[model samples]
Target chain A: MDKKISVKVCLGTTCFVMGSSNLQELIETVPAKYGDRVEVSGVPCLGLCSIDWEFSKAPYVKVDDEVIKEATVEKVLKAIDEKLNK
Target chain B: MAMNTSTPKQTSHLKREILVRLIKAYLSDDFAENTRLIPYDMRPKGSEVPYRCCIHSERAILRDRAIAGLGFSIEETEDSTLLSELANKAEKRDVPEQQPLTVLTTACKGCVPSRVYVTDLCQGCVARPCVNTCKFGAISIQNGKSVIDPAKCKNCGMCVQVCPYQAIQKIIVPCESACPVGAIAKDENGHAKIDFEKCISCGKCASACPFGAVHEKSQIIDVLKNIKAGKKVIAMIAPAMIGQLPCTAQQLKEAIMKLGFADVYEVAQGADITTKNEAEEFEERLMKGAEFMTTSCCAGYNELVDRHIPEMKPFRSDTKTPMYYTAEIVKKEHPDAVTVFFSPCVAKKREALNNPNTDYVLNYEEVGAWFIALGIQVTECEGKEFKTESSAEGRNFCVTGGVAKAVQTLLPEDLPTHPVVIDGLTKQSVRDLKKYAKNGVCDLGNLIEIMACTGGCLGGNSTVNAMKPALKQVTSYVNSSKSIKEQVSGTEQVKQ
Candidate 1:
């Protein structure tokens, strides 16, 4: 059985207000593109913005163990491909 | 303020970040001092200059953004004045200034004046449809290329539409084009300037500008100062708030209280009164042989009627807005309480400025920033029921057809209302309304629901969430609430 990659899209206030509201399409689009190989879900804040508080690079998404900063639809998909090949 | 319901842009992100930073600084121990560091902190001395020509230019625009965030008019603000001085002034100001929006000259792209011109694609067809379509003698074929005389052109765009090759194009200044009324135009500097007399405070210009140059002078510091003074600060939340955050309305109520609000009144509770009064007014108007009566809850639409379309006066319902009624009730209950209206758009800021009862207007974005500043996760907050619950229809006043539907439900039997919702008034729709008023008859419908922002109040400039989720959240919240009919009859039964 192929390992299913987990993706968590941050819907936290900071992230949503930043730009994750734009990446919401990926929740549906990722599932259709990669099928059962990847699982995508909108989660609450990952607490990543607080870690680097000086100047926030918000709207972060998590692909498996990797935390993608300033996440976009294309960025998440690319990160997923990198993992699948690995 | 990012008003686009279709997609939230990067400019929206930048705007939110500035607000968040400003609020954080305001909440800090040294508000005036920390506020000074906002532009520098956001863009450090040696940081990467991602947006503009240089780091200095980016910081200049950010400084202007902070000034707007501090609730001062950018156009009137001098470049020499420091941000700390503005912060101090914002804290001391008795009332907000004129013009809800201010143009950030530093950020303005100064888009070339919007005009019709013959593009390179013009084949200079012998058909001469371009010349024939030109009513102002603006188009002439010269050197085998169709040229449009800018001086003579009225920019009616008829030639652009009639062109066979589709070569004729209208280059639009986004902010200028977005205005339903021709309120914003370029000065000799080629930057945008708003005419206050013609402006309606619809915030269309703010949302339309990709440059994010148009800014709503925020009233955040005023609300915060009052809160800090240990005054009885009451929050009158708008109906559109149900869709803004990831929480139930009840949860939001609790979350808001955590922000130090003495009590939070659901504006929906007041919307119940508006719904009833508008229904009574509509019925009376119809009985008096009036062809149609438009809903008057939208502040932007009211501004249009006041300034641009006086003809719409008789047709417009005389009922006060839900915010007005709600603020009145809040004042009556707590005469000494500092009343702050939590709204979805800048139009309400203008509306609040006119009303004596409304002390200040805080938009959804500011509220979201406040939540972030205080680290209050609305989704995690325990739900606390509102003391006065609003009916489903009253709660639905945020959407386009809500007001008309509320009125129609009351007159469902005898005078079945034919509702015609005017979603997002545009140049064409504004003209249509004028015609309806001039004729004193509307064949389209007997009830007109005019919302200035497309998709109603939820699609306001200050809203954070996208359209679909916001709609879904609001719909679920409405479905759980009681109906207006049930509430009205319940009151009658009690009175009897």
Candidate 2:
């Protein structure tokens, strides 16, 4: 039995305004091969902006507790792949 | 919000950003005293040259843009009035008859007209195929190179096709190339000017202009004023708006309410009504042995038929558009409420102006600006749980073929229905439509769905997201909704 990969995309004001609006749709469209293993959801605000990390941008995504900075479709997918394989 | 890498997209986005900032400032507490310096504040003394020849010229263009943002036509005013004075004038006026689109002459590049010319690659062949192929004697050999006579040339491009070197090439102005209705043409000074009669207000020209010279006049201030004056303003959200902003539809509704809208109604619900009505009308027409019925949801498509293909108007579905149906519902339920349509189209601005039910219109970009100016973080807002009784099919109206799909769902499965979908209204599509209208041909399909924008409403010029992502969002949103039967089963019939 494989564990479902939990993917949380930040939908905070900063993230949304910074172009995270498309990420939800992008996550929904993750390849059918990963469909059964990955679960994608949107968090209103990840509160990453409060953290002063240089890479803690608005569009932060956490794939199974591994927070990916400056997240895009490709970055998130890659993170999902790494977690699923791990 | 991902920065568009393209220069033209960036410039247009900047223009919208500046307008939003200006509108936000105007609505602030100390606006009266600081209004005069808004343009200057936006483009301070030492700002880098953004677009034009100099910083001053850029600021001038910004000033004109600010004026257009206030719902005033730049063509009507040349006065060196202060921003405060302009604001005061804007406040005094009723909802003015606004032209859907305007061009800022200051920013116009006055691009050269599209012309076929022999390039340096022209190898002056002894056979003179270029000269021989030209019916108008426009091509001649000069100094061992082919020369096109501008005076004698009919721009037929026959010589180019006949030339072995393929030296002849055509140069097209971006706005002229983008206009499907051929509304934009060069003036005496070579600046692009729109013929309003021929213009469908598709806004393709505005988006296509690399210089960002073309603009759609906004009614932001008017709508704001209405809100401030305690008028009950009901927002009729378009179907395409599902994925336009970052927030969910519920959150977006709450954010809209925070912007002082009395209530939010999904235009998708109205689309559901349109689907039912259009399907019934189609069946009736088919039974009556009518030629064909074209869907009438897209304002650009409607306008194209109205202005360019009047003969096809009879074949166009008599049912009202989703927006109209939505506005009808809103106006009837809340008669005093001012219905403001939030669309993803510039053509809808014109449509709203002509409509009695809809009092004002705002595109996704303009409303996004409003959200920014008001400091309304959409994602952070606690969304109200109000949902419309619109079906999945109705909400799917944002994408290409969505209408046909919705109509198909309503019609009987065994019905001999042949549907044709015209995804985008290009020159060739218009020609075909005109030919069909002239010939009264019903062989292709009993029902034809024509979307003016390439990807339907989601592909509207003012949309925030790109087409592919937006379509994905819309599709998922539709998939999550209830079926048409469940949504529209008990709803009262909206008066036509």
All models, DockQ values?
A: 0.51, 0.17
> What's each prediction's TM-score?
0.94, 0.84
Worst lDDT 10-window in candidate 2 chain A: A49-58
Candidate 2 per-residue lDDT, tens place, B62-104, comes to 7788777766777677658666677777777788555778888
Deviation in Å, model 1, residue B476 alpha carbon: 0.5
Residue B186 Cα positional deviation in candidate 1, in Å, after optimal superposition: 1.7
Residue lDDT tens for model 1, B353-466: 889999999888788878777777777888888889889998999988988898887774868578999999799999998999899988899899999999999888878777
The lDDT leader among the candidates is 1
Query: How do the residues A1-86 of candidate 1 rate in per-residue lDDT, one tens digit apiece?
Result: 28899999988877776677678888888989999999999999888877545225778999999999878778899999999988
Supply the DockQ value of model 1: 0.51
Q: Tell me the spans in candidate 1 whose CA falls farther than 4 Å from its real position.
A: A52-55, A77-86, B1-3, B120-153, B493-496
Interface RMSD of each: 2.0, 5.7
**In model 2, where do residues sit more than 4 Å from their true spots?**
A1-86, B1-8, B30-35, B125-128, B488-496
Q: Model-by-model lDDT, in order? A: 0.86, 0.78
